[model samples]
Target: MATRVNVTVDAHLAIEVMLLTGTRNPQDAVELIVRDYLERAQRTEARTGDADDGRRSSDLQPYQPPQG
Candidate 1:
């Protein structure tokens, strides 16, 4: 089951998210972002056996936005 949500974001940020996720629809872009975030958080928690601290591991580099 899926829930409907109403959200507001900066247009430029939305556009960037859409491009980054290769999603043409704004809703899809938002869903993709949320899913990715949740999955990453779960993985981090599992690896550290603690709540996600929002810190990348030393072995992992920060993600950079794609260059045009």
Candidate 2:
């Protein structure tokens, strides 16, 4: 069985989420919002890749001007 978690949110915010999700139950609306957020984040991460995959600042050297 899944554990039940309780949270308190502003009534206006809850109503907004419920309206967006088309769910009458606050719990269902919140769940949908959370799931959608997680899915979007995962998709974004997949496209951009991890930050550690790029070059580190320590690998860079001070720029030098070219002499004519």
What is the C-alpha local distance difference test score of each model?
0.86, 0.91
**How close is every model to the real structure, measured as TM-score?**
0.68, 0.75
Error of 1 at 14 (Å): 0.8
lDDT of model 1 at residue 51? 37
Candidate 1 local lDDT, 1-68, one digit each (tens):
86887999889999999999998988889889999999999998787875356554655888999999
Model 1 is weakest, by summed lDDT over 10 consecutive residues, at 50-59
How well does model 2 score by local distance difference test? Answer: 0.91
lDDT of 2 by residue, 1-68 (tens): 98988999899999999999999998899999999999999999888777687655557889999989
Best by lDDT: 2
